[model samples]
Target: MDILSTVELNDCPLCLGPGLLEEEGGHCVYATCLDCGCHTVPVNYRTEAEKLDAAQRVAHLWNVGKVISEGVGE
Candidate 1:
């Protein structure tokens, strides 16, 4: 299984700012740091359906993950 398959916030590595953290990619979580202008993506977990159910959350996770790994948000 790829890194994404085994990702979960509980076991994730990076710790970012508050406000609903989400997966940043294969092994990361990204969040917009209000404290800092730089978009921050802390190494985190897979976007779980149960944990993150809203469309905005899902999309945000995807975008954040993409940005962290691929350097662009979709």
Candidate 2:
């Protein structure tokens, strides 16, 4: 089974809008919001917990109004 199929994603924490999940080399990477252009950091495929942690961190930063740098997860 694909790793992505097992993961669950939430709306953009910044704008509470829809977003797209990015992938590279067949691995789940980051998520980007369609409305605000905010995105999460590229998550490593080491473990499921790590992936979720990265996503949560991104959401937390957005929630606190921190500016996420661009060109990430490219």
Clash count list over all predictions: 6, 0
| Alpha-carbon local distance difference test for all models | 0.37, 0.60
Poorest lDDT segment (10 consecutive residues) of candidate 2: 65-74
Residue 59 CA displacement from its true place in model 1, Å: 13
Error of 2 at 63 (Å): 9.6
Clashing pairs in 1: 24-28, 24-65, 28-43, 28-44, 29-42, 29-44
Judged by whole-model lDDT over C-alpha atoms, candidate 2 comes out at 0.60
Please give, for residues 1-74, the per-residue lDDT of candidate 1 as tens digits. 33333333221112343233445444444444332233433543446443333334433553444323233444
> Across residues 5-72, which tens digit of lDDT does each residue of candidate 2 receive?
45455667667777666665544466677877877666655566665665555445445545354535
Q: Relative to the unseen true structure, what is the Cα RMSD of model 2?
A: 5.6
Model 2 stretches with alpha carbons more than 4 Å out: 25-28, 46-74
Q: Give TM per candidate.
A: 0.21, 0.50
| TM-score for candidate 2, residues paired by index | 0.50
Candidate 1, poorest ten consecutive residues by summed lDDT: 6-15
